[model samples]
Target chain A: MIRRRFALSPALLMSLALAGLLIVVVLDLPPQPGLAGPVAQAMDQAGVGHPVTAVLLNFRGYDTFLELAVLMLAVLSIWSLGRRDPIPARPVQGPVMHGTLRHLIPVAVVTGGYLVWVGSSDSGGAFQGGAVLGAAGVMLMLSLPREMPMPPALLQRLGLSLGVFAFLAVGTAGLLAGHGFMGYPPAWAYHLILGIELAAAVSIALTLVLLFLGGRSRKVRHDR
Target chain B: MTVDVISPQIYLLCGVLLFVLGLHALVVRRHLLLKILAVNIMGSGVFMLLLGVAARGEGGIDPVPHALVITGIVVAVSATAVALVLMLKVKAATGLARLPLSGPED
Candidate 1:
């Protein structure tokens, strides 16, 4: 038999060439001090001890606000698609999964809350906490024997919009008070940021769980 | 002296490699799920690049990039959620989880 020729796919070749160029560029770059100095200088005024949290919630609060809006839009788009098909029945859960979940859900809630509270001075934040909460919700959705009914539509909507509304209210109040839009007075910054974080964490968790569900509430009429 | 590959710049190289790999997969793969995965890989590569760049600061890591990456992660998750739902809707309508190849006109 004739020896098989080795084939070189163009995609692989192109990717390799691109990677090589990128590697060369990255290696050749000079080191530069970033915004760390300015951030440190302004840390006291930022009202949060953690630099990352200061940047996220105080310095660039609008970005975080818009991010929440984007999350809301995603859920809305998913809901517009159609109602989720009913989850198929599964075999009864074993005691291990049941017992594990019973313990884990409470722990998850506490951990999520702790993460949000600790975010001001630590490495955790609303998003991290919200993700943990969302994971808990997903676990509940997957493991629960009976179909979990969607919460009342109005209540769910309230939770979904809570973050944005809280952000807007704070921003608008700032504007009216001459602190500028989204600006917190130095003394009030920490409390305001904390409040926003709590609301955002709740909304983010709800949005994530809704996204996982992947459709509108079953109570709503399906319109396609 | 051997080139130092263990520095933070190593992440930059990995990031670029990841971006290219994901791009290649995105172009070569036909399945919708693979496309979604490729896009996420590309996002991860960008995040890695940001972190790597942030690490280059002489004093301490740049908090701005850290914040940006955090925001980006949430945005990426929302986008992926929408994409997955769209993929499902496409499958429901077309009975195929892929796009129709548009070949050159005869």
Candidate 2:
């Protein structure tokens, strides 16, 4: 088979031109303060010490809520495709993988918990922490034998919906209290934010694990 | 002038290059896995651009963009998962992991 010599295809040329234009444009962005000033001004009222967390969980809670919903929707779509294929069993050369998983899982749990907690005052949050936990779950799933049973369907469903449910509950409460949707009473802001983060973290982790699993498990009976 | 100084402009340029490279790959690559990876690279470029912009604030790095980027990352992950599952279904149904070429010359 004759391999075609490399040439500047139309696609390559177009992308190259586009890159040039974008590079020139991005080099001189307008000098502006951005939202940092506004975010700082409202930090006292936003409840969280960390600006990013305050923005995500308080000022822009609706976005986070919708993000969780999107994640759930992805899992739903995957389930609609078909039941999950069991993870293939690959023989380990030694107990290294299993031993590593046993040691790492505990550490991951602790780190994930710490990340969620520190998110209120630092550069960590539900997504970061949940990713760690999800990785741990994936490891667990990969190491398990083919006959190993997954968690109960009901329990899985609960975990998947926990984030969205918690966010909605908080938002509705705010609406009822006339603080507007997703608004926490200033006094309860910290607690509400923390509660939502914890729930979101759990949901995110479970959702990621499920996504990795690729579809619903057939072994677990689904009640109509 | 010594070229040792780093700035957000460097990040912006790199991001643009990455996005363009991904777009080029997406157009040329026939493999489903390459397409997915190209899309991810495109997303990373966008994320990088957002971060560069966030760093442009006078007082400090902007929080709103940071929040938006976080949201975007989650959305990207969700999209990639859906795409992967869809790819598998396509593979199972068609017995090919690559897209059919539209052009006859190849």
Candidate 3:
């Protein structure tokens, strides 16, 4: 009973310690608010004129594009390792996964398309929506386990390169226009975001899926 | 509602439970995939704590940390993919998962 009584006392002591620490820190710290560094300042500035998408796709679009290329190089390195055993195609048949996909797949595809279409305006966009659709594909792959044709090699490469290609193309287009690389001089933010989102979705989805499949190693054994 | 009126008993208890669960999974699970899952659970626990910080900061919720969390999700997925691939290769070659067993007899 004494120990039980003191347990509450210890709890009170702990809370008091926390309160004291809070007061100490509040009194001791400087009152300056907002970002303390240049990088954060830059991010805030870039994100202000447009949604986070514009900052990612246009303001620092060159780096964003380069980042995708880096992902491509990783994929290419895997291919160069001489490990390209493609999965054979499988026939499709099933009650369909969770019955939800029956509703969700179409909805996700439409949403992805809509995001690609209206990417400049809202929370929904190609990157976010495409991932959703790709998730539908992953869901399909998991559920059917039998249906769906294996993705062709060229299509895979195209998917991998799509983001970089679009990024560079847009940047070079800007350069040719005398605005410099990735420049959005005249209110072309919407167009640029669209390109980035479209390419990025495909690139990210394919790269993610391929990464999943790349680990299998064939074994050879001979013994009677 | 007044801040003092609220009790943090559940959140703290859940945090501790999640933390211990992650640790248990990491130590006891043999499957590399499951261990990674446990690591993710631990990461989530830390994320929960960081979110609590964001919640309590004098300023309204910090967008910077939220953005960083978004970026972190992608990075975590990539790292997990890479680690799983490495584990699979090691498993294929050795035909056994995880570091070799430790024992009193060598």
RMSD of 3: 8.3
Mind giving the per-residue lDDT tens digits that candidate 3 earns over A85-145?
Answer: 3345543544644566688878877876776666555455445666666676776665654
lDDT of each: 0.91, 0.90, 0.58
lDDT of 1 by residue, A1-224 (tens): 35335546887788888889988988888988899999999999888999999999988999999999999999999999998876666448899999999999999999999999899999999999999999999889888876777788899999999999999999899899998899889899999999999999999999999999899867644333
Q: Estimate candidate 2's alpha-carbon lDDT, on a 0 to 1 scale.
A: 0.90
* Clashing pairs for predicted structure model 1, backbone only: none
- Which window of 10 residues has the lowest lDDT sum in candidate 2 chain B? B1-10
Q: Encode model 1's per-residue lDDT on B70-89: one tens digit a residue.
A: 99999999999999999999
**CAPRI-style docking class of model 3 based on DockQ:** incorrect
Ranking by DockQ: 2, 1, 3
What stretches of model 3 exceed 4 Å from their correct place? A1-32, A35-50, A59-63, A66-102, A115-119, A145-147, A172-182, A215-224, B1-31, B42-62, B102-106
**Candidate 3 residue-wise lDDT, B18-52, digit = tens:** 65567666765677778888888776765654444
The model with the greater TM-score, 2 or 3, is: 2
Candidate 1: true contacts recovered, fraction: 0.96
DockQ scores for all the models shown?
A: 0.87, 0.89, 0.16
Q: Least lDDT summed over 10 consecutive residues: which range in candidate 1 chain A? A: A1-10
Error of 1 at A53 (Å): 0.3
